[model samples]
Target: MNGVENNLDIKTYDIPTDSDPVHDNPIISNILLSRGIVDRKQADLGLASLSHYDTLPDIKKAVKIISLAIEHNKNILIIGDYDADGATSTSVAVMGLQRLGAKNVRWLIPARLTMGYGLNNNLLEQIYQKKPNLIITVDNGISATETCQTLSEEGIEVIITDHHLPPETLPNATAIVNPKLAENEFALSNLSGVGVMFYVLIALRAYLSEQKILTQKINLADLLSLVAIGTLADLVPMDKNNRILVHNGLLKIKNQQCPMGVLQICQIANINPADINSVDIGFKIAPNINAAGRIHQMDVAVECLISSNYETCNKKAHELKKLNNQRKITSSKMKDEAESQLIGIKKILNSHHDLFGICLYDESWHEGIIGIIAGKICEQMNLPVIIFTNSYDDNILRGSARSTHKINLKNMLDNFYQIHKDKILKYGGHAMAAGLSIKKDFLTEFSLLFNQECGKLLKNKSLKKEILTDGQLNPVNRNPIFVRNLQEVMPWGMGLAEPVFYDDFIVLSYKILQNKFTKMFIKDKNGSSTWNVIYFGGVIDTKKGDEITIVYKLSINNFYNKPDVQLIVQNYTLK
Candidate 1:
């Protein structure tokens, strides 16, 4: 274990003051001020959140495409992604159209390890087996020019709805509804894949309503809860538009009338539905849905989500729990082996570069766990990371890239693809994260090329990771009132982050409990500040009597029927 502890001057932050006139409430004001929300209306908007139903752009175009598909009685196959957003988007598109009296709609999600991501000609062939009249791709297909071209050549109409960054050349589909297609045009460019699909559904619903083909039995607002889950889970930028969708979704979850699957997930996570937020989705809901896709079939998750039957939903929830547990164990084992292999890379140990970027591949490693491992390493090492693994039966090498503030992983992947087009089989992603598949034998070549690329682009100053804090606060204010207010404003994820507070504390006592967690009792000068810090898996390098600066989120800990406030430590350093 490596432990570094020393007393150092605490770094101060430019904490927003009450006089800043940004917000009237101290808690909301502090939170908004941290994110540059200086105006009262902006704060209110952020807190209230928006909806896809309220802000569906290009409604006329979207509705026209759906109505054409319906009138033609085309076989519409909803092509989805393997993650939560994709699953929810697929569900929404299929159900929404089916509700609109379209009986021929079907759904398909490419196997992550086999066909890979996006709507491709090969995937179209798979869908063609069903002999559908039309194909609607959700959460993907923006970059699928060749696939869409093939569909068009075969006299198949394609409607693409996606939120991923589009390539320089757009696909010539029957109709395309991508918010990021052009800058400064769409107000909700930050929507998730599911959110985009939801917009299409909203337009379709409106057209059906006008035609008197459907009843008002199902309100689009009812589906916002799913949209919220997908949006928050996908980690889309929580800008104004996304915040509204998520905020309203939380309101539904809090009301406990969501699909049985969501309620079951909430119960399994022990999160109060009425109090759910973005963290709960990220830490609780999304992980389980993703685990199914990573380790098994995503269809299990999708089925669970769409099932209204309580027994089936409960069973699906339990299965997700079991798979998530297996995923946790698999990730830990793989990370250990990965680190063991990295020990020989002297450059990493010497700290020659301040930022640690990793790319490791083993045909023996399970492909499903690589992305989880990449994210875990990024969090643990505070650096951008890319984890590669090979398929046991195929020559294809696949990888998932995650990033920190220092470097943009998506841009890195994009640039690499541009230069090594011949070597890259496929690659596309958003700004902070991405996925790629390449020839297995080219692993060494890609790593060396990526290293050279980083050397040319990254500066030494960009190596160190920095933590942003809202500000310091008196320990006395860490009471129920403050915690409750924070909870009310929660469902925080991605762009709109959960607030983290920093303060100096003297370690009164410390111990490694359960051989995993590091528990510390700490207080500030004059004993005015006191708190208990629990760091999960923090036992590796910690000791008693250490003065430290800690960054943490406030959470209520209920164990053994005792209720108390707990600090979920994000990072810490010697004071």
Candidate 2:
């Protein structure tokens, strides 16, 4: 079962924008305004308008230390996590440091299946062997309090650039540039791992330029493509500041001025560079990049992004494609198993015990992929979910959580940690998602407590998921040209969502794709015009000549060079 609620509601947004309508089409203007676009200034997503480096906490100190490392020719090793954000952050750090003349720079990313998440003992042992004079961490190290202390004892100075929520006791690093730090500006709040690294690189570049220490000048905008991919992949908020970063990055990527690896991945994913958007990265490129970390080691993915060789990126992209295929197969198997378990768990819900939080565990599951499964299940249940699998160690279990709007997951986890501090090995994440490790023996008790805590917070909240839409589409604005124009003002994601419109239609004909997705020929009931619609989930159970209403977004069909506009379904109702 798809688990999508057919009882959808259409809520037209009337939130006003500060300025006049920007787009020629009124529907487009209304859609933009609903997202609370303030003025033309926000619409102009140029690099000059990017937040200054000085705004980040410890920027000056971080730059000074990195500068000294470059000037003194000290060996510097970049420690990175094992996700897309981590891989891209490492790429930016390595490439930026090398460009700034740090000759002895190298990177060591943790292996997901073996080394666990961040700066654990396994990673620390490897770092110690490297014997680097300086260390820089990206996408991680915010919660590595004890690990950072160990590195300090080893006489290695660390500069941390991360964006995760910081722990109560911060890591003992020379400088921490996490935007989530209390001292940072609000503009930095939505910065992803790569975004933080980009700010650091810019700050270091500025310092070098001020000191007249650099002979060759380079524009850092070339790196925004990586920043965009990583930021979107991490699913960070798309606030105005983040929009500027992503918008500029898309410009560079579409213009073919980005790293060869990005273009190569796009080509392999069958994405046309001339017409790429945030959706392409979300659906096509990011998954392949993430697959390297989930199915294999991320070092190769990092190598692909940092390497300038055409043949190297080509080979790496193909390898990532293969990994992505494996990831899909494994993910499908896990998802099926999780769903089967959910069916059994629903019996408890039917017994009048409301399920506020869900905990699913399987020893045979792949730990690297639990987060994705948790997210999907959370969506299906409209509640908080934590999916756990057996860790590399025999006695431990690793869990990844995804939460609904009803509960603040980080706060709930913090409270749980406070009560059971000795039970959790490591736990840190944001409001929407988190990861943790614990003894496999505590699974039953932890699941009960988790459900209880979530029940407290979500007692008054409904478990049903809402499908919010941007009203109905005007017939005049439902053409290929207007849809193409809508694609221009993009980088839509969390905080700022893509527009969905609802309309009544007659299902003229329908065919099931792979017995899952439905491709239908729909005709506007108010007019004589007909259009193509692709319902993404399993079959909508509609047949020929059925009168129905469809909720959808206008999307471009990239079947060939000349793309056509089609409706991508979000929801539907039969009359």
Candidate 3:
């Protein structure tokens, strides 16, 4: 069911009047300039070096602490979150430390079902049992002020490397390395948790080399594949620095220079590592790895990342794939339930227009899959959504929030907290996504307040689904060579979105594929070319001879050794 009506609008970019090196094709030039790329130099910024690592806040301090720990042969335990970014960061820290000749390096990931997130008091007890002299947290711990203080008071040094936005009161850790802490805007926006950890390792390597402490040679570049996967999967904006990291990592994957586990994951996903792109990592590899953290235990994913044996990695990859399949099944059922609940809520509220946000709860819903369900509901409804389920604690309900780009979810939650301070137990996250917990008793009030806040925040804002298009496709440039060249230039994610163009087409014929996808032949209204288009996940309502305005991205469908030009339909409207 559609929650909010959407208005379709095509955007046009201003032509650059400066003497810039433009693309040979005007379509490509417009796409690049629309994304704020003015010239070839700006486009080439993805080739920037990792030297910017030195500029990150507290990098040197983190390196010093890690080096001292390694030299002293102290037991170092890494605390990581359960998501893919945390998994990759854990793997990078464990492997990087071992390669640097650290005698003992172990990692602990909080089970999403049990210990909850970050370095909580409960998780601290688990870490205390390990008797670690130092604690290195990756991908989390930025908000654990009390936990950090407790660890410090216990004489355990802590290094926090996280990418999440920090709170007002900083944790008293030995060193905190986060790009968001950078003074400049450029450094503050891009790096993911894995990127932060990678920088720490880079600084550590440099420090070790300068001190002549390195016993064996280690190439940090070998870990770029993991970095790439984590960065893409984390959904961070693909700024220049992030692009450079992803580009290099994709190259490593293409050259078969990544870890055995990564290669095995690619194999299990039916992807050729040599031909994989950022999209493959996000849609295929990341989800499989993330499934372990969500449905089972994160250690399975961490083990898969750190394993050096191809057989062992392949085995773990299979396990992860199974978990992912289970996760999908669970998420699908939850989505159906949530949609039904939403319809009920709409009736109760009396008007669909009143629903600026949706809050749903189900005791039977799997808490691990609620976030995915929330995201799916948010996308389908075109409204901010929060899905709640039973938490480990009987008295508390855990919820995950997903919102449109216009809404700052974390900030919204913060505003709610200001009014209903006693209701929300705890919450954290970024602009588009967040997680929270509240007393079960307050769920009703909290839900009402949440909806009201969303209404007040989004007053007068249209809830229409906006399909941003790069003007219209030039029929002359719609060919295999043009699409191939576009794909070769760069990877796309977050801020650097994949180019989507819209144009009128005459539907020639259509056939249902596998009862799920729709395969159609459509001729451009502007040209005589007949293009094959595939619409996945859903089918269009139009039939043969229907003229429709279609939004799609140019794609190459490689079957066997032959590559054919195909349009992957994003959205369409009857003309």
Candidate 4:
């Protein structure tokens, strides 16, 4: 490692780096240091100002089209994708339109199974019937060249706000607001669909202000929380720009004044308003919202995000929770079946054990849950896994890909696309995860080609699975006062991981709690206070009097309204 030690010895390890003394006041510095942002400048950049949210590279072209739409009172319809980024982008379009004083702004999100991904002909018909003057796309239009052309033929202008890689042929929309476009000079090219849409709204707001059309009272910053939600939920890398958006959004959420609907969803999920971190949005809220669109209509989810009335918000929140529960049950059944089927494939199992990838397909598997199953398999085996499902409809197949430490799945897929472009229908995603479709008959050939393609990409086996610890913790920093303070400063995600600490400790007492959890009380030799630790999964290997190094995260466990700070063990190694 460049700046830090890679050894696992806890006593000899000091956190690889120290927090900046002057700018990163001790507490903030500790948090930054925990995340590997030890430099003062890096911390400042992460906590950058809203002023940095400027005109995107395509602002002038996109703004020109949007200004024309507003001037002519165009009937605009936004076509969005089905995931968190899509939903958030849809909400942004709807809310931003209302804020811009535009009427007849509607959104259409295709069902994951029926209409398929991206802008399809079926959704085009629905939008065309409304006789929209313009059809804008959020999170999906970059790859829909044919669909955009069809809309253009119907005398409708198209403005695309997406963050996916452009295929060989670009969509002939009025303008594209994507940071990845070759024409784009935007500093952050990895903006999510919602982030791209928010940039358009930023440009729109600038246009409206320049036109002196501030007939309505609105602060664009009020929507930062929503942008943050969409960006984080989509799992975009928390680069400098995204970090600013998330940081500001967390500030809004901390103030307890985010979207009433989102607030209601959080309350229903039992997520404390104060402790709403990136994981909460990604794991808890995004899934619920996506569940609605996956198996049913997205109108309910959209309504949940836009509803201002507490009763409606609460009602939708409960409905979304029910839908999410149902989704979990359905997905669990599907996952179990998929895993069992994979077990039956002796050749596949043996291949997976020896190779760096796993690809399994069963015609009976449900498409909605294959992605989840693929992700689970990836984490379990530490290899890239792709799970495929044959859809009920003719000649359609969908699959999800998840990767481990060594491979960037998206980049690898890009290479695969270049080779098998004719076989692929549409595909776009990030480094760790991706979704793609192909004809059912080509399933065997595609799998062979995919493996051949990945063979060249994932050849290394020495990518060690090492946990990077933030070194020793300050004894004074783990008490009630400091731990409580840390809780309020959360909602951390990708670029900002929560604080983790490690130390050599002697296990004092150990007990099994509720069978599934291991509870421990331990102390180190440095006079550090005794700590309570909880471990999920199987039994711990250590016994009382056994010395081990513990890697854990500090958390304030709320028990019956009593606030107690505790350590949650992630991993342990025998001394």
Per-candidate TM-score against the hidden true structure: 0.89, 0.94, 0.93, 0.84
Total clashing pairs for each candidate: 9, 0, 2, 1
Better of 1 and 2 by TM-score: 2
Which candidate ranks first by TM-score, i.e. highest?
2
Residue-level lDDT tens digits of model 4 in 1-575: 00112233332223335334523246555555555555655545344344333445566887778777877888888888888788878888888877787877888888877787768777866776778898888998888888888888878898888888788899888887777775654556767888788878877787777878766557766567778788888777676677777767766776876788878888877778777766567767788888887667777888888777889988988898998898887876676665565566545546544455677787777677788888866754556788988875568788899986578888887887887788787676778888888878888787666666566666664534456666677767777677655644444666666666787788899997754468899887567578788875336766788786777877776789877788887667666
Q: Ten-residue segment with the worst summed lDDT in candidate 1? A: 1-10
Task: Quote model 3's TM-score.
Answer: 0.93
Tens digit of per-residue lDDT, candidate 2, span 52-136: 7787889999999999999999999998888889999999999889888899998999888878776767787788788899999
Measured over all alpha carbons after superposition, the RMSD of each candidate to the real structure, in angstroms, is 3.3, 2.2, 2.5, 4.9
Worst 10-residue lDDT window for candidate 4 reads 1-10
Candidate with better TM-score, 3 vs 4: 3
Residue runs of model 3 more than 4 Å from their true location after superposition: 2-6, 13-15, 22-24, 45-48, 186-189, 347-353, 511-517, 537-539
Candidate 2 similarity to native, TM-score: 0.94
CA lDDT of each candidate? 0.74, 0.86, 0.84, 0.73
- lDDT score, candidate 1: 0.74
Higher-TM-score candidate of 1 and 3: 3
> Which one wins by lDDT: 2 or 3?
2
lDDT of 1 by residue, 1-575 (tens): 12442222234345456547664467567677666566665555442344444344455676776787787776778888888898888877876787776778888888876776769866866877988667888888898998888888888888888887777898988878888775675567787888888777766777777877666755666577788889988887777777777778788888976667888888877887876767778888888888888888788787787788999988998898888889888887887777666665534445554324667776677788888778767776555667888753477788888876667777888777888888788776665677888988788888767655656666554454566677787788787667777766645777667888877777888878756568888787456567777987446365566677777888876677565778887777774
Winner of 2 and 4 under lDDT: 2
